[model samples]
Target: MPSTTPAPSDDQSPASRALADAVREIEHHVATAGWDAPVRVFALVRTQAALDAEPSLAAQLSPETLAAAQAQSWHLTSIEQEGLPQAPDLETLLAGLSWPATVDGVAVTAERVVLPPAAEAQMPSDPDEALPWLLAHPDRQDVRLAVGVLREGSTWCAVRTRANDSDDQVGQGPDVVPGLVSALRATLA
Candidate 1:
């Protein structure tokens, strides 16, 4: 699905704008498949660079994807990673990853159950007991955190909560979810 991402402001750096577009695009892409989807990862690269590397991909992409990619000079193309290994947490999954030189950046989307600060204080201390507590929380919100980081350190995040779910409602900024941004940066480092 095409995203309704806004053009980054004039004050923003080129890297920041591109990463914002790429991350938001991935957020909408995953949203199209519905909620509760598995963690999805992607290798980000310049659209022209990717086409140069693999000409056959031109034939594989949909007409819209191809035209939009080629039309924008700074457009980023996301290559979704498949067969991801199971991991207990986002940190663990990312700690084991490293991208190749060809990849300009990376992006990942994961679903999380979020709650207000007050709700966290009532949670169980034990991991085993925490599952039920989290699941049964009355104020729980389902959120998708889509974070992207460039090898040069630019970052962008898109956050969507099920309660106010809509492409237009997705929040976008550099630190909307800082912890996830840092984790994504670690993978690039």
Candidate 2:
């Protein structure tokens, strides 16, 4: 079954919902470049806070964006982190990172090949050798995971399968990938 983002639950605070929105925006933006993409990262900042830091930015920001920021106390702007070093270990990359106070939160979008439980029996036990097996596994589902984390510990996750293939099919919630979520949270610590 395809995954889709549901309406925010009643318990979601405005800040949490805004983080979700930023995560969704990052997810959709990454999806536009297609699948099998590299690990893309972003820094989320409150829109008004950004403008406060640099009034000159007002000219660059659109009226609609400014309006949305004013409409809700939760609006955020996602700024992409370009030129990330190529690393085989995502956790390693994240471990070496830390965000400044100016950054309200951090987000990352990455693709993974998910294999069925039955297919796991044929996999190599060696972590180093698993990449080739995972790549060759025909029963695998290519899924992209977009995760965002706030310094206050709030988190949002979005997942989209290559099979489903659409923005509407994106599934979202908190901590979809627990391990990755933890790593992202550490960046804001």
Best by lDDT: 2
Against the true structure, what is each candidate's TM-score?
0.89, 0.92
Which stretches of model 1 miss by more than 4 angstroms?
1-7, 62-73
The per-residue C-alpha lDDT of model 1 at residue 26 equals 91
lDDT (tens digit, per residue) of candidate 1 on 95-189: 89988888889999999998789889888999999989999988998999899999878888888988878988888778777888888788777
Worst 10 residues of 2 by lDDT: 1-10
Clashing pairs in 1: none
Q: How many residue pairs clash in each candidate?
A: 0, 1
lDDT of 1: 0.85
State residue 161's C-alpha deviation in candidate 2, in Å: 0.8
lDDT of 2 at 181: 94
lDDT of each: 0.85, 0.87
User: Superposing all C-alpha atoms, what RMSD in Å does each candidate have to the true structure?
Assistant: 3.1, 1.7
Q: Total backbone clashes of model 1?
A: 0
The segments of candidate 2 whose C-alpha lies over 4 angstroms from its true place after superposition are: 127-129
